[model samples]
Target: MSDDVYTGGCGCGAVRYQAEGRPVAQLHCQCTHCRMRSGTGHASYLVFAGTEAVTLTGAVRVWSLKGDSGTDKHHAFCPVCGIPLYVTFAASPGITAIHPGSMDAPERFAPGFVTYGLRGLDWDRLDAGLTVFDAGPTG
Candidate 1:
């Protein structure tokens, strides 16, 4: 991956942010929470460094939900446009999950894997080469 910063914004441009380091991982999440939040079969996410590496410029509406692991997951979205932007897991408090579609140029990052495959829609075809996991992988 390139050692360049990635910038992105909400659909209505009401919320903008700049992430200053290369992403650790990019993946398509098929968890139930993600599916509901994105209103799609899967949600594309890019894992960034931390909140310190990201600068936010607009008010974001946050919705906290419990993940399968019982951790509180905070989903942030642009109130004006109702576009999901990021998600933060209380378990992994340091990392930030950014929605690839919210980025100004999403093509810069490609999803490397598909997570929570068991909850994925039957009609959705994920990348065959990716490491499919029934749930989040243990580090």
Candidate 2:
């Protein structure tokens, strides 16, 4: 992973993306929006501090949804396959959260913390270690 370059595409190959550099933080978000969007208990995300670190190509569609912060979040995906690739927020335009599954090496995603634990389902378990927050971590 030290090579710091990765590329991946949507299931239908209609959308592709490339990202450079390592992630600022990797975490599992248990927010309802995350669970529903991922079709699972949570979403694994690799957050990069610089939005420009990632670039996308091909036909991609974006859906805007409100985030916990009360700001619009832009979710990018492949319309053909409906595979979510990344997300950016209106509040934090400098950051980008890329779905680890949308990257070439998903195994490289080593989540260091868990957020939105208040939204976590007891039935869906995750061993995300000690750094856990009830909701979004407070400053």
Candidate 3:
């Protein structure tokens, strides 16, 4: 991992976080749930280790939802700002999916891949060079 540290927070500054080392991967997810949650063409995320890597400040509200795979996914966001920050899967505790847009400098990490390609909108086109996955790579 690169030595760079990435810092980010919620829109209202109610929640802040700093992650050391470069992200393992950045993703653009076009899944239906992501579209609804982000209210955009796709949701951009940065993946990182869950343990001893993400240092967070302030309180965040969590909401659990059943994923397409029939597993529970806990999404954490700032209660004050209501900005989605991170997501954790019940089946995988070692990884965290962070919304890149919540970061202080989202442009520092461009999405490296696109997921749930089958669900992508017909009008949107992600970068052609990035790898495309039909579903979540976790499964």
lDDT of each: 0.84, 0.84, 0.83
- Highest-scoring model, TM-score: 1
Q: Which digits, one per residue and each the tens of the lDDT, describe model 3 over residues 1-139?
A: 2447888889998899888767888899888888888887788888887575678999999999887667888999999979899888788787788888887878787888898888899777788999989988764
The candidate that wins on lDDT is 1
**Clash number for candidate 2:** 0
lDDT of model 1, residue 4: 71
What would the per-residue lDDT of candidate 2 be over residues 13-107, giving only the tens digit for each residue? Answer: 88888888878888999888989988999998888777578888897889998876567889998989999999988888888888989887788
Candidate 1 worst ten-residue window by lDDT: 130-139
| Candidates arranged by TM-score, highest first | 1, 2, 3
Candidate 3 clashes: the total is 0
Candidate order (lDDT) = 1, 2, 3
Residue pairs in clash, model 2: none
Alpha-carbon deviation at 55 in model 1, angstroms:
1.0
Ten-residue segment with the worst summed lDDT in candidate 3?
Answer: 1-10
- After superposition, candidate 1 runs with Cα above 4 Å error: 1-3
Q: Lowest-lDDT window of 10 residues in candidate 2?
A: 130-139
